[model samples]
Target: MEKPVHHFSELFEQLGLASDPDSIERFIQRNAPLPETMPLAEAPCWNEGQAEFLKEAVDEDADWAEVVDHLDASMHKAQ
Candidate 1:
């Protein structure tokens, strides 16, 4: 079985996003944060596939659920 993704870095890698530390840091700094209450599937920041993946993790509470939830909260918090 594949290992679970516990950190944002691994989650990003799983989602085929920018997993590089510098890129992830810059992404966090550059983008507008999503609202805490917003559905990740409906977030403006995600592409359709990325949104679907996040939604699936949340809706099904899959192995990636914890990481997805953490991402949701982290992406919503202001610096």
Candidate 2:
């Protein structure tokens, strides 16, 4: 079984992001918790494709869904 992702940096890699520490930290610092009302799929941090990926993951409950959910929850909690 695939190991679960446990950190933002890991999630970024899983999602094919550039997961360098500085980039990851910048991403976190900039996005943190999206506005309480914004949906994860609509968070401004995402480009069009990234947002679509997140939306489909959540909508289809794809394998990445769990990681996406984790990220969504974490971001929301950061608020």
| Candidate with best lDDT | 1
lDDT of 2 at 74: 68
Residue lDDT tens for model 2, 1-79 = 8745456666698667878889876766778777889899898878898899889988987777887887787677763
Residue 4 lDDT (model 1): 64
- Clash pairs (backbone) in predicted model 1: none
Least accurate 10 contiguous residues by lDDT in model 1:
27-36
lDDT string for model 1 (1-79, tens) is 8756578788888778789889887776665477767775677777888889899988998888988887777677887
Cα lDDT, model 1, residue 8: 78
Query: Per-residue lDDT for 24 in model 1?
Result: 84
Q: Give the TM-score of candidate 1.
A: 0.79
